[model samples]
Target: MSALGLKIIDESVQQANIWINEVDYRVGLVNKQRAYRLLRAVLHALRDQLTPDTAAHLSAQLPIFVRGIFYEGYNPSSMPAAIRDKDDFIARVVAIFGPEPPEDITGAIGGVFDVLDARLSPGEMAQLRGQMARDIRALFAD
Candidate 1:
């Protein structure tokens, strides 16, 4: 994984945890485990889909975006309250890939997610986790 991708995943995990806590506290809904699983799924998918060159480029740029976010004096703890939906959070993750990823990569990503979503229930985030693991292993076996 690119360093920036890694950092984005790490930051995203932290942000997700904060969101989960807020949801639990405010709405009595706790799904930290599921959230973590989803994050892992997405990160794995991203890593698998990107070429080494793309990954390296993204890794280099991610810190600058992250630093900008920090420079705005944004508190990580407040992320949960600010991000009210999963899609919005995902948009941020997608933004790290730049506005236009290569067409082949974009198609592959769509395929991966489509297969994953079809094979697993949205509530069963872990299902995709295993699939992602299997896919990664298969890719490396080539």
Candidate 2:
């Protein structure tokens, strides 16, 4: 049990750590904080590109803490943004970096997608991928 005596909070933190670690490994980054920032940036970019209901469905499968991160500063009313093609999507992720962007932006995005693929169900992943353009969908591929 955690200090707060909440098993759910403890478990959610554990799960979030597992995800951030996986992202770090996938992105080949030693710094977990960088992995976390990369994860958050990609998630926000992806969420803005998804339909509100689709975004909700995807969020349901996320760890409680990660889901909170995913939805941070989200505005559903203006969502499913006009992000077309891979370049545009990558631009959105890069825009979140605010200077000092990752060396391999596509790899960073794909690293987060890989973590999502490993954590989320195939059905939900398919639904999420269906919302993206074909070029962007390539990042989710094995």
Candidate 3:
């Protein structure tokens, strides 16, 4: 008989692997580490801009293991910041990548947006996209 703990752990690990693979596929990278860095950076930016309720809703759509990454270091009390400008949104995302941010920041955000768009429903994705500024919304258009 399979142990319950093993089952749960196995399932979670599998889901995490799937998510990483998906990110790798979306970003056109064979490197898992690059995919993970892109994933975490984009997630943190998106999380900071969402309301607690909306953030929770988005988390529900994520893989079980990825959901933890989505909420890592989340502080709802200080979130949903006024980010009506695309530069502001981009800057937030860039900062997450550390001192030497990637040059193709828009592509990075677009890649994560594509993954989310594929995993989420059209309407649900639109809801989240609508929350962003016009230029930010265009990231999904690509």
Segments of candidate 2 deviating more than 4 angstroms: none
**What lDDT does model 1 reach?**
0.38
Rank by lDDT (best first): 2, 3, 1
lDDT of 1 by residue, 1-142 (tens): 6556786677765654553343233322244443333333334334334344433433343334322332232333432223223343344435543544323433333433443344334543342233333533332211
**lDDT comparing candidate 3 with the true structure:** 0.80
C-alpha RMSD of each candidate structure in angstroms: 18.2, 1.1, 2.2
lDDT (Cα atoms) of all candidates against the true structure: 0.38, 0.89, 0.80
What's the CA error at residue 120 for candidate 3, in Å?
A: 1.5
In TM-score terms, which candidate is top? 2
- Angstrom error at residue 92, model 2: 0.6
Residue 57's lDDT in candidate 2: 92
What does the lDDT read for residue 81 in candidate 3? 77
lDDT of 2 by residue, 28-120 (tens): 988888888888989999999988999999999999999999999999999889999999999999898567768988888888898888889
- TM-score of each predicted structure versus truth: 0.26, 0.95, 0.86
